[model samples]
Target: MATTNQNGGNRRPRGGRIRAGSSRRAQSEQTELHLLRTATWLFSERGFHGTGIRDIADAAGVAVSAMYYYASSKDELLEAVMRRTLDVLVSSGEETLRDVADPAERLAAVIASHVAFHARNPRAAKVADHEFHALTGQVRQDILQQRDAYETVWSSILSAGVHDGTFKDRGTVARLALLQMTTGVAHWYRPHGELKIPQLCERFAEMGLALMGASREGRALEACDVNLPDTQLLLRRAELTIEPREKPTGL
Candidate 1:
């Protein structure tokens, strides 16, 4: 038999124990997600060193004790957030390029996926970009490891394109140039602005192919046509917003 709570929830008992661990796990996961969201906002606005554990706890509406239960310290929390951000980018890139056989198409897919991720996760992307100096020792190395792995995807694509005679700039400079250009979308993209997420991905994919010296004839660079997720939808999922900035006083 199962016990019913006041909220109409059922509690089952097995082996002299209640199935309360599932509920506890769900609560813990929710708390951790809130903490990550709060930290991403603070780090993007005030920087990693400027944000304190209490600030994150208060923003997430959790007690300081509860915050500590999830993240032992501010540095640990920062690393966790950054590590997760890079992990997401790496995983997304790999998944996006998995079925892309053509070298030019693979490069285009990488660019499109990168742009979408940044536009969706602006706060997390900004924190990852600006807070590298704040991490120390092993934490910095761990985050960079994930970053390098993600970069390798693009590097391999570029190398393959060059080998196939479809790309010309087969050097580190071209890779950094394309990456810097696409990653900058996080700083200026707006969900409800002039261009929607799909248009942005298309334009960015074209620009990336052009930067790589690939021919822009016809549909050769239309890599984002393979079902990339919308940036606005992803932003909504992460609960991050982008508002217009006010003009400076006496500008």
Candidate 2:
């Protein structure tokens, strides 16, 4: 009961109905994405407590009643944003580490990726870092588990480097310190400033290596290729846009 359409695809009975269904699904997806992007920006600018469901719906240009179709509550939206940020971080970190053999090189690559991500998507990074305690119950636990998984990646790399005599055995202390140092980049990095992402990556990688006591062997890390996704492309993929805000005075 199917016939070939112009594109050689099978056309079934009630094809108009099928097309309409598909269109509605696509529109629904677009609306949810718009809500998520708007929520991410709002939550980043105003703390989660300060941003309400109505705020997100209004900013997304959706009726307040329609938001419940996508998310049960504002907490659900925050959880979605947090999960999305972690998913990107974990997947990107894993991809970056693939085929990178040397311990120092691995550490450098991670530092590069971390610094680049924070610098490029500062708003999302800020939300991920600052809004942890805002989530409650199982949602908070789930986010914590995800966060630990990402931290384990760094800890494993540091452990390997230390075992191989490339880095100091500072253990958990080193891992926490390195993450704090790199994540802080999201707070002050300016796109129009003198430091390009690549240079910033290199600088951060060098600092990370030094922090791990690999300074003597870190010369090679400085030259390691720091490949990362383009910032604009990443923002586009996430359906998010970040407008420039007034720069804070002083360092």
TM-score of each: 0.78, 0.79
Clashing pairs in 1: none
lDDT of 1 by residue, 1-251 (tens): 13356799854322111123575877666566666767778888889989888887777778898666666678766776677777677767777777678877777677777888888788888988889999898777877777887788788889988887788865899889988998999899988999987788878887877777775343354444334444454334333322112221211
**How high is the lDDT of residue 245 in model 2?**
36
lDDT of all predictions: 0.70, 0.73
Candidate 1's displacement at residue 152, Å, is: 1.6
Residue by residue across 1-251, what tens digits does model 2's lDDT show? 13356798965332011122464877866666667767777888898999998888877778888877667678877777787777777777777788887788888878877887788778878989999989999778888998998999999999988888888888789999999999999899998998987778778887887787773444433434434334344333333232223221110
Who wins the lDDT comparison? 2
Q: After superposition, which runs of candidate 1 have C-alpha atoms over 4 Å from their true positions?
A: 1-23, 216-251
Candidate 2 regions off by >4 Å? Answer: 1-21, 215-251
